[model samples]
Target chain A: MSPSERHNVTVHGPADGQPMMFAHGFGCDQAMWRFVWPAFSDEYRVVLFDHVGYGGSDAAAFDRHRHATLDGYAADVLAICDELALDDVVFVGHSVSAMIGVLAAAARPERFARLVLVGPSPRYLDDEGYVGGFSEEDIADLLESLESNYLGWSSTMAPVIMGNPERPELARELTNSFCRTDPEIAAAFARATFLADNRQDLERVRTPALVLQASDDAIAPRPVGEFVHDRLPDSRLVLLSATGHCPNLSAPEETVAAIKTYLAR
Target chain B: MTIPAALLDESAEDLFETAPCGYLTTAVDGRFLRVNRTFEEMAGREREDLLGKRRFQDLLTVGGRIYHETHLAPLLRMQGSVREIAVDLVRPDGSRLPALVNSVLRYDEAGRPAVIRTTVFDATDRRRYEQELLHARRREQEVALELQRSLLAGALTEGEGLELGVAYHPADKGLEVGGDWYDAFWLVPEETIAVVVGDVVGRGLAAAATMGQLRSALRALASTGFEPGALLEALSEFSRRHELGQMATVAYAEIDVRLGLMRYACAGHPPPVVVEPAKPARLASDGRSPPLDAYSFWTDRPDASLQLPPGGMVVFYSDGLIERSDRPLQAGLDELLASVDELRDARPDTVASSLAQAAAGTTGSPDDVCVLALRRRPART
Candidate 1:
């Protein structure tokens, strides 16, 4: 399948406008940017897509080895950019995707002009002097939680909500909202997201970046955000009053305003 | 028979305090705002210690807390409600309560989420049942896999002037084992080798069991010195009479190394490929018939013969090797032919592995694949 088909890429706004691509976090699809993407649609070409195995993207394209790390995801980003012939792109990434954007920009510096990272953590596990929060045991507990929730999700929601012609509304609402994925893929993505150590990759990213951190995010704490900022050579940190990991969903206005201010600069 | 009005006159506050399920309210960020008596009892904490001091996530295990942040919180924010979310709440005394939680996000007038109302239900029995089901499914998968491995085990007949190799790969997606099987054994003392590759019609334990039955039947029929076509004819009758392996497709071949002769039959399977020395590999498209049990009455199965020159090879493979969802059948066949032609100079085992690896590729295939190759060594002077 073509990369566009594999990632389920959807494009909006003027055909000639500057491209602004939004990549969602680990838990959800591109719909996580529902409220934020529209705010820039008129001025920027808004690009949205589901990661393979997440939303409408072809689940058959999910290769365990190909998607074993964040680099595989970054390759998808580059593929999208190449397929669309996009240049000087403005990339917005949430949670785990923020590091993916970093990897993409580091690989092909000319394709990206700026990166907006929301609630990103370079390393989730705590190190000797650094406080990334959580531990090895905590990550194991998180995997167990994911497995149980996936079980509940597949058993209760997948059969009735997925591809049911009688309940179009439910399917529409769930098109991107906690949509079902293969449990093994979900676990693999969780491992790739939490257990990753990409602290060194930040130094290689020459693109100007904006770090949007939520004040009280349990997933990506304030110090972790600061750690990411300190590593990037040309990045600024803005701590929003938003109190959760997903300010894009919880505080869309603040999230939009921060991105608009950074782009304006 | 209705209860008296006076007896049913319980106040809303009383009901809230003494409901059967634990009830609590929290801020949008999960900070505990109000806790009912039932909730306090369930958590084993005093109201003063719980209220305004603890967030809903604070009561969960580390894993449950992560789930709250990643799945539950995002879901509630998107859908305004989340139901039947399984979580383990760590009690004040260091014990755990397996609970099913339902929470709704209440928005203030400005359209901002202001409060969350949650209900927790004890789900110890349900959780246990679910775990048992999961365990049962895993055990079934393990048994099926083990059965497949044991049935395919044993060394292929190896002797002077002959070499054989086989490769088998199951689908990697689900727990159910697939129905692809391959076998090679000595039909005569040292002159001929019988090779077979077949695919049954289903998946899981039933498919594996059917494959085993068909494999055994084929070996038994071959042992009676039946020709390639006659053995398949009997195998089809065995499937119909036993009501097993309906619509199964198999390819059988007998290679006579001393005479450099190969007789093969295909029952609704891809024709075998032949790679001769100093020539491109090509598929043999003759001797084909419908799958086993495809018709109520059977016709005589036809056999085709080819003369394998010195240093010639023959490949028998399941349909998966030449069928992919993304490409046409002819395209896949052409790719296989090309891959085989490239490995003409490799050893028998190397060629078999290369063909299987090339067909399966890096991505996991949707179906199982099996490849069995036999080569006739040049006659020594």
Candidate 2:
């Protein structure tokens, strides 16, 4: 399948404008950027997509061996860029997707003009001297709890979760289309996201990066964000007062301003 | 009888404190604004300790916090409400209380998200029951897997002037044991080797058991000198009598290595392919009959014979090798013929594995695939 079909790529803004790709984190799909991407649509070619096994992306495209590590997802990012022939692109990634952008830009440095890493953490488990803000047991609890919490999500809920936004009346019937994912795929992605350690990979990225750190991100805390900024070759950190992991949703004005400010530089 | 005015006045307050479920209100960012007495008691903390001091997430394990920040919080923002979310509440004593939570985001007049009203239900017993059910399901899957593996465990037959290779891949979607199976063994050592591929009617433990019985019946009947066609006839009778593997499809072939002779029959199965060096692969489409125990007018089955050339290859496979939901069965058959011809120069093992992998690489087949390739050794100088 074409990468666009496999990843469910959607495009907006002027086709001739420079591409600005927005990738959502682990929980939600491209809809996570509904409030943020529109800010760039006036001046940039906005690209939005869901990762495989999440949102509108084809779940059947999920291959266990290929997606076992972050590299597989990174390959998909590169594929999407190549297919669209996007260069000097502005890639905005949130939560786990921040590291996915890192791996992609590191592999194809020339394709990306700037990397925006929001609430990014290279590792989640606390190790020797560094604190990733979570213990191994905490992650185990998370996965176990995820197993027990799939009551509201089933096969019937999938189409609603992946409902078309153009039809507002249909979309209005259920508010559940936001973060629900296939239970098996969700567990697999949870393992891939929480158990990853991309600290060594951060140094490989030569492209300039803007790190958007939240004031109280329980998932990717301050120290973790600092670690990401410090490890990157050329990066700047902007701490936002938004109190959650999702600043784009909680503090969009400030998030948009931060990116605009970074791009102006 | 008229109710007392004093009792009537306290009823609303009494219900909040003594309700069966806990109730709380939290700021949009999840900090607790107020918590009812039931919530206070369930949390094992006083109201002063919880209200304004702790966020609802603070009471949960760290995992729940991640889930809340990543899944729950975002869901609340988009949908304006979430229900039956499972989280564990940590008490002052460090003990965990499994709870089910539901929350609705309330908006102020200007449409800004205001406080979140939530209800918490104790799920200690429910969690235990869920775990038990999951454990039982996993146990059954494991049992079915173990049975399938043990039944298909024996090595394929190998001898002088004969090279045999077999590859089997179970469906990737689930852990249930599928109905496809392959077997290769010497019906008469050093003379004739019997190769069979079959697909039974259903899945899971019953299908695996049926496959095992059919394989045993085929092996036992083949040893007693039943030809390819007669063997299928006897097997159909056995299936009818035992009510096992009814309507199953099988391809049975016997090759005489020294003589370079082959006989085969397909019972409602995909035709086997024969590959000769520098010659396009062709299907052995002559000998065909209805599936086992199928209601049919034709009683007697026919066996087809072919004089095998040195270095020639013959393949026995289940329908999975030549069937896909996205394309016609004929297309898959054509692809099989083309792939077999391309791999004719390779070893039997390579040919078998490559074919299985190619079929599996596409939108994966829901059914398991089995391929058994047998090639006679090239003529010696």
TM-scores, one per candidate: 0.95, 0.92
Considering just the first chain, candidate 1 attains a TM-score of 0.93
Error of 1 at A165 (Å): 11
Per-residue alpha-carbon lDDT of candidate 2 for residues A1-265, written as tens digits (9 for 90 to 100)? 6889878799999999999999999888888888899999999999998898776677767766667788889988999999999999999999999999999998999999999999999999999999998888999999987888774466576556545523534534555556656677778888899999999999999999999999988999899999999999999999999899999988888999999999999
Best by TM-score: 1
Q: Single out the weakest 10-residue window by summed lDDT for candidate 2 chain A.
A: A163-172
Clashing residue pairs, backbone N/CA/C < 3 A, model 1 = none
Off by over 4 Å in 1: A151-170, A173-177, B1-7, B362-364, B379-381
**Which residue pairs come into collision in candidate 2?**
none
Q: Could you give candidate 1's per-residue lDDT for residues A1-265 as a string of tens digits?
A: 7788778798999999999999988877787888899999999999998887786666667766678899998998999999999999999999999999999999999999999999999999989998888899999988877766663346577655434524545656643345457677788889889999999999999999999999889899999999999999999999999988899998999999999999999
What C-alpha root-mean-square deviation, in Å, does candidate 1 show against the real structure? 2.4
